[model samples]
Target: MMPSPGAAQPPSRGKARRGRPPAPISPGTGPSHRAWLEPVRSELFTSGLTLDDLVDRSGYSKTRISELLRGNGYYPAWELTFSVTRALGLPTPPLRRLWTAAAREAHKGPDWIRHCIEQVAHETEGPPLAYRAFCETLHQPYLQYARAFLLTDPRARGVVAETFDILWLSWNEAAASPDIRRYAWRLLRSRVMLRAARHQDGSPDLRAAVFSTDEAHAVQDPGHFMALTELIDLFEAITRLPDDQMDVAVLHYLCGFPDHQISHVLGLTPALTRAVDHHARATVETLLNAPNTQE
Candidate 1:
């Protein structure tokens, strides 16, 4: 039999939920993806940078950059992500984080995505499908935060419950919120942070957020919509990563999680988390770019 995750520790509150069935996502659709483009769009207007300007600077074809901007097919690889960030002279960290965040959500299996889409499709006036996709993608950001910072599954589960409670009570505010995704993210993080402060057990408290509530947008910009028809070597190679590295890389590149948060879930130092992410990317890039692997 496979080893039990709970073999060493006592029953965590998370256990009850874990044993329980997952919340049913709507049954018809898959995780929908779309690219984020506002920063580049805004910059194009303000800085007078045209498509031609980005092409010469970043060396990507106009079609490629246009695809990236228009939320069209193909996930923005790191090269494209960096190219556009530099082309716009925007700080890469936030955009990269949000970009990764969107990717992680997209990488979630087809079932979850389908459910999210179907559920929203049924709503007469819900946020756009893109935004609902964001909400579905972040379904576990709190649990992730709790695991590392809360340091125990039960407490982590408790935090997740409480955070959701806050959400339930604030439905009016949420309904009125212009950016529901970001609004929910901040609420979750704030509650997590407050709990982290109260639960300090005299150990040095480590924080794992990539973008703080103030720095990151409440709802992520719609980005990372990779069309599966375009899945290639790097995509396949990503699946080969060790679980830890894959999670870190996913959150870092796909989910936009910073090292601190990734480390918390993996129980590693921030520096080590960054290293693993680098290693994973290096490995995937190598595998992705390798030729003649047709054995």
Candidate 2:
């Protein structure tokens, strides 16, 4: 039987083998890999399993296990990740989706991904038609928002795809919520922010430098030049705003959502939505006036 997250967990114990620690995950590793790594690391810490213990439990060599934990070398197949998660007493479904997304980020081909997935036992018959429809409806806007934030199409698509898979796993709770859209929106936001680049102060770093590229061409059209300049500054300011205000601004300005739609999407009252938008613009304007605030 597959281990459930709620299942009785193994007792924590200290490492059974000691030596120089595993190599750190390369700084250039993709966000998808980094995202999947968090829970694996947490489970390892919580279970207090050592490298030797994992090798014994997972039936993989010590070096392979170490490489998997550190996210070094090639992307892991679903079979290998599943074995490690099972050994650590972690749930498989969510991790499987995460691993799938990470595999795509690692540039593994579709044939390889399908092969990896086929190695695992089925979790459910399949997601319901309603769930599939909902996913399709949100896919474009979600991709657009993710792309704008991450500044890369591939990373955005991976994050959106992973978000949908995660939502499928909890569709019942989401459907029962007062506002399904709001619940799913929060879920997507959390996933995106988890993988987003951050400022030294820990706010999101939107990496607005892309706006400044092709300056010569942009300057040839004075109107376009001015707009791009303001846009870069505005987005930089938006990143530093408090979370609520930032979300409001992104949905309002970037996604082109009206106040009422933003209200529905975020489960906020119309009055509150307008108020948040007002505050967001006011703050952005203030930040724009402040020197050295824009990156």
Candidate 3:
């Protein structure tokens, strides 16, 4: 009888009695191969990255990555693996162990290959409940912040909810996979721009709309009130900048995109990204100083 993919096969009694045992299994010859590879692949996919992305980041060739994926070539050398792990900010231990094992199984026979394939299949079919839990953990903080942001602009309430819904849906489908996050950021930037355009004239009054009459009336801490007022004023000043500059600034501050990621999302070269960021900073500085001069 054939052994199940994850199950160990029993040794034949005749072979055992013949004073010769079966050859020892190699490191990668059992059920563990897919156990290792699948999770790493899933992580990369969820991170919105691909093998090609790793190649780009690591300055490695596409063919090398393809060979690694197919389990037909040299596994990533330690240096290459370290570089890839750092670039993606992924945990390395699991992938490292899997690769080590796969290397051991390289010359082993068909049983090892079959076991690896089974592991891969199992890994790819992830647990739905576990995935949902993961998504909720990732999104809860962002959702809270979005709610707070929306409270100041009732006009944006529906749109903000819709945006969150889309974000959550996309995250579930891919777990905020890097590619989806990139795409979502673009959509979010567009939505922010569209909302700003629609309510450009009324944005000042919209800030006032957030504070209920009771809350507005009951504020006795002058410093707290002033700080809130200053923040609102700062946002207003930001809105006055040109679209490109404003976008870079908002993405940097509000969405927390780094300059390199911003460049990719915006299709700007590094030099152009720096220039826009510099201009936006100067503009905001000028606007911030204007209020003090008026006082």
Candidate 4:
């Protein structure tokens, strides 16, 4: 029988080293691989499972399990990883998606990916097909939107990865919602916003400096001053728009997603997306065109 997730302590084994501690993950490891490895390690620590217990539960040798846990040697196929995760009582679907992402990062070929997946095909029924489809469909746009808000590639990838895991864990509830796209999009947005820097008024702090050419250019061209100021005001104005309008504007204008894509991302109809985009532009224009009382 599998050990309970809430087990107070891992069962004892006769005198033998539990397992060599997992080596520190290499700094050059890609973010996708690290994301999955981190959670597996956490589960190992909290469960108090030793190498012996894991070998018994997972039917793999201590050396192989050690390598898998340390993320050393060749990238593991899903079969071994699934066995370890199952023994540790981690949810299968989320870890599977995470493993898939890491595998792709490792440059594992499609045939190999399919083979690894097929090896685990009979492992429980797994999540619904729709859930898997959503993972594939939303990943890139989610990453782009996250980077636009968070302004760091690793941080953005981290947020997107976490969002997918959360969605995987809550797939049933999310799928049952009136609008799955909207539900998933909002969940992703919440994760991104949690890590984003905010203005004093609680708006997202999008840096206008990101648009600047260079210090020399700014000094050489007097018109650059006016353009920079207007850009800053425009970003601030975007931050103040209502949630739907702001999302549509950013996904459309900032991310360069077409109206149809923005509609798909935000779960709005194309017509509604266009309407929101129009309102966002009008609102921003009004904010920018307003006279300066301080001058």
Models sorted by lDDT, best on top: 4, 2, 1, 3
3 versus 4: better TM-score goes to: 4
What number of backbone clashes does candidate 4 have, counting pairs of residues 3 or more apart or in separate chains?
0
Segments of candidate 3 deviating more than 4 angstroms: 1-187, 193-222, 291-295
lDDT per residue, candidate 3, 262-286, as tens digits?
A: 6765556789889999999898889
TM for every model, in the order presented, reads 0.28, 0.61, 0.33, 0.57
Candidate closer to the true structure by TM-score (higher is better), 1 or 3:
3
| Candidate No. with top TM-score | 2
By TM-score, the better pick of 1 and 4 is: 4
Task: Give per-residue CA lDDT, model 4, range 76-133, as digits (tens).
Answer: 8888887787776667778888888789889999899888888764445465688878
Off by over 4 Å in 1: 1-36, 108-295
Of the candidates numbered 3 and 4, which has the greater lDDT value?
4
Task: Find the 10 residues in a row with the least total lDDT in model 3.
Answer: 1-10
Computed on alpha carbons, the lDDT of every model, listed in order, comes to: 0.49, 0.73, 0.48, 0.75
Clashes of each: 24, 0, 5, 0
